[model samples]
Target: MIPASSGTGLPVAVNGIEIEVIRRGAGRPLLFLHPGIGIAPEAPVLDYLAEGVEVIAPSHPGFGHSQLPATMTHIDDLAYFYLDFLETFDLREVIVVGVSFGAWIAAEVAVKSTERISRLVLADAVGVKIGDRTSRDIADIFAMTDTQFAEMAYHDPRVGQRDTTALSEAELLTMARNREATARFGWIPYMHDPKLKDRLHRVRVPTLVLWGESDRIVTPKYGRAFCDALPDARFELIELAGHFPHIEQPETFARRVLSFAGEAGVPVTAVKRASA
Candidate 1:
């Protein structure tokens, strides 16, 4: 297991699978779970959050440098893997922040784990069925041009254009593999657990639903429904942003998250503004 540079890294073993976990900063443990499909656990969003509080980001097995088991098939399998993961790490009173597909996993983990999870932040999260509106399919996305893929992934079209040309062939292939894995788990009807909306009442933890105001992928309406379903939750929209708001508006995104973490008694400092 490679050590996470920000602090002493912890090699966590769960369900016979070893995950690389990086812990940085101090105070309450805030676990950041990356979205599926080409994202490593150490995504830039996690790095942005790390500046304020202790952040634990783990690479999902089979993605990045982590080990992948041959028998895994469903997203629920990943859910259980993380439940065991939290127990192995002895992380209690945790605050989980998940983006996109990771948000779905975070919700699953919160419901299944008996531990004390203080709050949950779902940013442009999936895992629920909306009436008449279908989530994007993996197969369709794969067929699109790189520009199309970028446009769908980001709110600002320029971000997509800027990054597409620089992506190496290896990166592109990894993205394809991740998409295939996601399809195996989330491509069925609804692309999410049908009962998840009903189960929101059982979550018990305070929840924050964040969305990109201009996100065409998931739609802002879905974000509101997710927030409304949770008993103790609030929704916020990041202006001029798309699906991945944290990347598009890092400063605002991080500030809002840090504020939420603080409200949950997680002891995170407010993000400091830089001088002009």
Candidate 2:
């Protein structure tokens, strides 16, 4: 494992679309796909992950400053774009870590091709349809009040609290942009791809399904099904956390990830925590 370091932030153009990317640490490449709400450069999960390996966290198009192509309208489009991204950067045997909506994208990319990725970790992922008619595959964050969503999304409510008065104009606008992108890709299918479940077998990479035991958004049962569908996957549960376990419990989450990858022949360090 390499010594600890922060990400080197920059923007790179991929097939005419400019995507914001942060690359840091020095070891094997570990690509981080951000959640639907987007990525804050200082997010602790990235920092912790970087402590152990080279971390590449890129903002999906339309999420941050990344430009969205006119033809890209669905999550699968993002998947294909990322596949191109992998090839463009010539990344091989990369370890992909994703959370919530981001996890969905990772799964999409893996199902399509694992030529670049060796292993994957999906935490509180929102994709695939396995719920019954009465139970929703994923919660409706759009319809919930801020308080309601916060209570459901985090184990500690304070973590989810956002003081609007402290926000800058740019931050507020970015939040709006994040919401818009999420709606375009996730809202219609309610955060899932109807056909994705059946296609999971195509994922040849070993996967780790991490779930927040306290998550009210997507149950562990759903997580189990997700693991089962994959050709090779195992499930791990994080206590004292909700949907975003990596944020709620960075130390435990990072250690779990690092340990999993290490056992699979990838060397990544798991040190003390930060904010994701």
Clashes of 2: 3
Candidate 2 has a TM-score of 0.92
Residue-level lDDT of model 1, residues 1-276, one tens digit each, is 224465433566676788667777677778777776545444566667778877887767765445678787677788888877777767788888888888988887876753658778999888876554554422245367768767877877887574635789877777666666667667674358876766666676777899999776677888887777766678999998887887788778878888998882432223222111
- For each candidate, what TM-score against the reference? 0.83, 0.92
C-alpha lDDT of residue 24 in model 1 = 75
Error of 1 at 276 (Å): 53
Residue 50 accuracy (lDDT) in model 1: 75
lDDT of 2 by residue, 169-189 (tens): 999988989899989899877
Top TM-score hit: 2
Candidate 1 — which residues are off by over 4 angstroms? 1-11, 38-44, 133-143, 162-166, 264-276
